[model samples]
Target: MAAVDAAADLLLTAARLPDRDGLVDIAVVGDRIASNGPASVAARGAIDLGGRLVTPGLVESHIHLDKALLSDRVSTTAGTLEEAIRVTAQAKRSFTVDDVRGRARRVLDMAVRNGTTAVRSHVEVDPGVGLTGLEALLPVREEYAPALDLQLCAFAQEGIIRAPGTEGLLRRALQMGADLIGGCPYTDSDPIGHIRTVFALATAFGVDADFHVDFSDEPLHMHVREIADQTVRLGWQGRVVVGHVTELAAIPPFEQDTVVAELAAAGVAVVCLPATDLYLMGRGDDINIRRGLAPIRRLLAAGVPVALASNNIRNPFTPVGTADLALLTFLVAVAAHMGSPADLRALVDTITVHPARMLRLPDYGLVPGCRADLVVWECARAEDIPATLPARTLVLKRGRVTVEAEHRVVERWR
Candidate 1:
C-alpha cells in the first residue's frame, strides 16, 4: 500500500463483489464506490477480502425502537396479540428517556453489527407517552448517523381514533423531525378513520405513510383495501407502506390475488414482520394453525414488493431474537415453505434489495458510484448466506470499516 491519496481513501482487492464475476478489485473514494479498476490501485489502504462474497448492506424496513427488548418486563400469560399490546402499553408508562435510549441503543448495536446499514424504526407517539419516545430516539438517530441511516416513523400503536389526542401528538412528532407517519387500523375505534387521519397527517407533513393494517387471522378486517384506495386518492402512490396484512393469508387465493394486484397497481409496498407475528398471532386457534404471514409469493407474483423484518426483539410480542437479518430471513424461509434454491435466493432480497426499493434509498446497491455501505460474508454464494445466518462478516459504512467479526463458536465437535 502506498501513502493514501486524499481523494481515494481505500482500495479493496480480490473482494468477490456480488452479481459480478471473477474476483475484481473495488475502490472507495470519499464514501462512495469509485470503480471496478485494476487491483494495483493507488490508495491509502487495501483490504484483500480473500475472495469472499461482498454484498450490499442489509436493510430493516419495519422495527420498533421503543417497545423492543422487553421480554422480561411483562409476561404474555394468555399469549395473545391483545395481551402483548396490553403489556407493552403498561411498560411504556414508566419509560424514562434513559430507559428508552438504553433499549434502543441495544437494538441498534445488534442491527449494525450484523450488516444492517439502514433501519426504519417505528417510535410510539400517542397521548399516553406523548412524544417522549421520539424525544429519546431523535438523538440516537444523530448518534448513529455515521454508521447507518435511521428513519423514525411517528407510529400510533394504540390507534389514533380510539386514543383521543393521539392525532395531535403524531403531528407534533412529524414536525419535530420524525421522517414518516405510522398507524395501526385494527386498534382504532374506527379503522377507516384511523387510516384517514394517518394518511392526512403524512400528506400534511409531506412525509411517507406506514401502517399496520389488517393484522388478524380472520378475513373480515380488510382495511388494507381502504388503505390502497386512500393511497391512490391522495396521490401517495409508491410513498405508502403497509405492514402485517396477515389476514391476506386466510382469504381465498383468487381474492388474495385480486387484492395483491390492486396493491401493486396502487404502488403500496408491504412489510412482513414475521418474528413478532409468529409469536403474537395464531395463538387462538388449535386446528389449522395459521402461518400468519402476508401472501408473500402472491404479492411478489403480483409485482408488489414485500420485505421481511425483525419487528420486535425479545419483547412480549416476540420472545426470541438475535437481531440478525440472516436469522430473520431463515425463519421466514422455513415459515413460508421456501425450500428451493431459487426461493432461497429470492429470500435474500426481502432483507436487502427489496427493502432498499421499498425505502427508495439512494446510492443503495453494489454498483460503482454507490455508497460503500456493504458487507463481506465468509460464504461464497448468496444462496448459502442465509443458511449461514450471522456468519463471520466485515461491515463498512460510507467506505469506512465499522464492524468486523472473525467467527464465533459455542461448542465445536471435530
Candidate 2:
C-alpha cells in the first residue's frame, strides 16, 4: 500500500441511524472508512453532517460513457433508438482520444458531485472506434480508483459473438486491462446464439458478463428462457447479468412470476435502468400508451437479485443525466410501484449492494475494514429521498473528500 498524507484526513460526526434517521457521522483515514459511529474521534478535521441522511456512495451499475459524453456533439431529432444509434455512429469518427477523455472526465465530475462513487460505464469497443475510446477512458478509471471505483465494460454495442471479429476485440480489450465483457444480444439477429457465445467467452477468459437481455417493448424480444437454459447448461448460473428485460412489463402477471423464479434459481441478476427506460420504451398512438419499464416489482417479490442502473447519459434514449444512482432509485421506485418502507429499503439495494454484487465488489456497506466510500445527503429523512432527491452534502471516496459540501455563510458587514 502507498503511504498517504496523515495530516490531510477528516472526522465526520452526526447523531442517528446511518441509513434513515438522517444523523450519522463517518470517519475517514485516507482511502477507506475508518469508523462510523457516535465517537468523537480526533483528526485533522471534522465535518458536521447535522442530522442529514447518510448513505453509501452511489453506484451506477449500467452507463454508456461513449454515448453519454457525446452530448455536446450533434443532437438526435427523431428521439427513437434507431435514430440515436445512427447519429452516434456518424459522430464517432470525430471523437479523438483527447476529446473523449475530456468529455468523460467532465461527466465523471458531474457524477462525483452527484454522490456517485462507483460507476460501471459501458465504453463501446465495436466498430473499430471502440478500442480508441477505451484507450482514452482507461487512465480515467485508474485515476479515480483510489477515490472512486470505476469499472469499464468493454462493451460490444453490436452483437458480441455474432459480430465480425468480436472475439478478437473482446480479447484485445481484456489484454488492455478491461475488467469485464459486455454485449447487446437480444437486439442482435441471433440473440440466443450471441448470448451463449458471449457467456462462453467470458467464462473462458475468467471475466464477468453484463449483457443487454432485451430493450424492446415487444413480447417476443424477451430472453429469460434462453438465458436460464444456457446458465444451467454452461454451469454459469451465478456469474452472468442481464439488464433491461423490459418485456416483463408486457408479460402476464403469472408468466412474470414464473420467469422471475427461474431467473432467481439461475442466480442471475436483473438490472433495471429506470431513467433510461422511462425515456425510451412504450410509445404509442391515440388512447393507447405502454410502459416500457422492466417488471422490477415482481422480480423483487420472487427474491431475484435486481439492481437499478443509469444506462445512458445524454444519448437518444436518455439525453440528459448525470451518473447519480440515487436518481435511478427515485425514478425506479415510482415506475415499479414500490412505495412501501420495506420496499424502499430493498430498492436502495439496487444502487448499493445489488450493483456491488453484480460488479463482484469484495466489500461494501458501512462495515468495519470496508472501503470508506460514503455520502451525506442534505435531506433529513431517507425515505424522503425519492420525492426530494436531495443534494449530497458531502461525498467521501475511499476516505477522501472528492466533493465537499458547499457552504453559503452570510457575514455581517458591520
Candidate 3:
C-alpha cells in the first residue's frame, strides 16, 4: 500500500508512444501521469530514455501461479490434460506454504522482469487444496505489491456441483481477498450448475467472473453463448471474463460468429491461452488435424474484447512458460497468423491496450491522467516488438522503477 505514498515527480524523456502524439516525453506525479509533452518543463527527477518505445505496463489477464514450476517435481510420461490434472492434484496435498510461495515468487520475478505490472492469477480452490493456495499467495501478492499488482481468482479446477462443498470454499476465498470467482465447467459433472455457482458467488461478493470454458477440441459441449446470455440476464456485463474457449475454433463458422456477436453484445471479454490449449487439445484425434485456439481475429472483428497471456508457467498444464508475455504475443503472431503490418498493430494492442481494458486496470497507459505503469523497451517501432522476446527492458510500476535491464555492444577489435 505504501507504493502510493512514495510517488515522486519523475519525468521520462524522449520516449515514443505509438498511435498517439508521436514521440514525446512523459511526466509522472504521485503514481499518475501528470503530463506527456516537452521534457524541458522539468520535475524532481528525470531519466532520459533516448527514443525508447514506451508502452503501458503489460497486463497478464490469465495465469496460474499455484501450479507453476512443478513440472520438475511431478513426472508425466503422457502430456495429456488428464495426467496434468491428476499429477497437480496429487502434488497439492504436499504443498507446504513455503513450497507454494517459492515457486510463485519465481513466476512473479519473471513476469516483472518481462514488463508485467498487473496480473490475474488463478489459484485452486477445491476441498483438496482448500485455502492453502489462497493463503500462500496473499502474502506473496503483498510482497510483490510494489512491482506487480496480483489479482487472485479462486479457481474450482476440480469441480463445483460434483465436489459438493467446493462452492463454499470459493466463497471463503473471495472473503479472503480473492478478486474473482473461477470455474472449469469441463471438470464438473453439471457444467451449467458450475457456471451458475461461479456467477452466484461473484454476484454475492460483488466481484467479477472468469471461467475456463470449453477447453476441448470438440465443440459439442460449448457454453460460451449461454454464459454470454447469463451475463446479460444478471447484468454482469463488462465484469465477466472467460478464458481458453478453444471450442470456438472447432464450432461451425456461423455459430462462431453468433457466439462472438453474443459476447460482444453482453460486453464479455475473452482470453485465449494458446500454449495450454494448443498443447492439450487434439490428443485423441490422430486421423484428423485441428487448430486448438480461440478465434482472436473473429472476436476482435465482432468487437468482443480479447486478450492473450501466459496462462501457465512450467506446470503440468503447460510445461514451458517463462511468465514472459512477449512470448505469448509472439505466439499469437505465429499461431494465429496475424503477422501483417496492419495486424501487427492489433497484436500490440492484445498485450498492452486491450488487456488493460479487459482487466479494468486503473491508471494504466501513457496518458496524462493514467498511472505511470509503463515499459520502455529497446525498440524503435511497436510493430517490430514481437519478432523476438523482450531484450533490454525497463519496467515501472506506479511511477517507481521496478525493473531495469540494459544491453550494450562495443567494438573492441576496431
Candidate 4:
C-alpha cells in the first residue's frame, strides 16, 4: 500500500469498491484521489459508507437534449422513426432559447441526481433550427460544471446533403464552442456522401465524430461499414462513435462478426440506445417482433467498446424516460438476456468505464491519482445494481459533495 497522506480534504472510510471484497479508505486531497487503501489518516471531513458499493460516476455517451421532453406537446400515431423525425422537425420551428434551456436543465438535474457525472448530448444543427439548440445548451454546460461535465455535440439530425446549408451550419456550431460533431446517415439521401462530409468536418476541426447509423428493424441500411473504412482512412481511430446500429441484430452471426471486426480494428466505439430502438423499431411486425438492438454480446466478446445510453427522454423517439442510467442497465439485462452475475456487473461498466473511455474523459476512475468523481450506491454488491435498481447514497464530483440522498423502506404488515 502507498503511504497515506497526513491530512486530506475529504476522506471516505469503510467504502466498498466494486469487484473487490472488504472495505478500504479513500483519501481525497484537493480535486484528485490521493490514496485508496487501509489508511489511518486525518481529514477535515469524512463519511463512513457502511460497506455500500462504491463505483465511479456514471457517463451518458449519446443523448438528445434539444429534442427531449416533447412527448406531451407532440402526439405520435405511428411510432416509426420516420414519423418521429417528421414530427420533431415540425416542432423545432417553434422552439425558443429559453424553452430549450429550461427543458435541458430539467434533464441535466435528473441525470446528476441519478449519479451521472458526465454526459455527451447531441444538439441539433440544421437549416430549420439553425444553432438555437447549441446556443441554448452552451450556458447550461457551465452552469452544471460544478456537478457535471457536459459535452455538447453539434448534430446534423437532418441529412447534410439534402438539408442545404447544413454543412456550413455545422461548421458554425463547432466554432461556437461545440465539443464535437455528429451525423445521421440513415436520414441522408446519399448515406456515403454524408459520412464523407462529416469526416471532412471532423478532420478540419480536429474533433471527434459520432454518428447515428443503421437504426431500423431490418438490415436495409448498414452504413457502419463505410464509417469504419473512413475512420481508418482518416486516422480517426479511437475518435469516432456510432449509436443505434440496431440493424446489426438482423444480420447473420457470421456476417455480423465481419462488421464487428472492422469496427474493432478501426477503434470505433458503439452506443446502444435500448429505449429508442425498442420503441421505434418492429412497428411493422405483427408476430414475433424482433428485439431491434445491436449485437451487444458479440461486440463485447470481440473486444469492441460498447455503451448503453438513454438516447431520449419523454420524446417522440422514446415516449418515456427518466434519464436514469441504472434503469437502462436493468432493461439490457432482460432484453439482451444478460442475466449472469458477471454480465450484470459488466452492464454497470457500460454506463461507467465504457462511456468514459468513449468520451476520452481524462483522469476518470476509482484508482489513486484519478479524478475524485465517485458514487456510493445503496446496494452492497455491484451485481445487485442491475438486478435491483438501488438508490444512490452519495455523489461526489472532484472530491466535493454534489448530491446526497437517503433510501428507506418500512414493511407495514411484517
- The better-scoring model by lDDT among 1 and 2 is 1
Candidate 1 Cα outliers beyond 4 Å, as residue runs: 1-7, 37-39, 408-414
Query: Worst ten-residue run, lDDT, model 1?
Result: 1-10
**Superposed Cα RMSD, model 4:** 0.9
* CA lDDT, every model vs. true structure: 0.86, 0.75, 0.85, 0.94
Best candidate, TM-score: 4
- Tens digits of per-residue lDDT, candidate 2, 253-281, equal 88888888888988888899887777777
Candidate 2: 10-residue stretch with minimal lDDT = 1-10
Candidate 2 error regions (>4 Å): 1-9, 18-25, 407-414
Clashing pairs in 1: 4-44
Model 4 bad stretches (over 4 Å)? none
Q: Which residue pairs of candidate 2 clash?
A: 16-23, 22-51, 31-398, 32-372, 33-372, 314-319
Lowest lDDT sum, 10 consecutive residues, model 4, at 1-10
What TM-score would every model get versus the actual structure? 0.95, 0.90, 0.95, 0.99
Worst 10 residues of 3 by lDDT: 1-10
> Residue-wise lDDT of candidate 4 within 1-414, one digit each (tens)?
474646899989999888678889899999899988898889999999988888999999998989889988999898889999999999999999999999999999999999999999999999999999999999999999999899999999999999999999999999999999999999999999999999999999999999999998888999999999999999999999999999998999999999999999999999999998888888989999888999899999998999999999998899889999999999999999999999999899999999999999999999988999999998888899999999998999999999999767898999
lDDT of 1: 0.86
Candidate 3 residues 141-240, lDDT tens each?
Answer: 8999999889999999999999988988988899899988888888889899888888899899998899888888878678888799889999999999
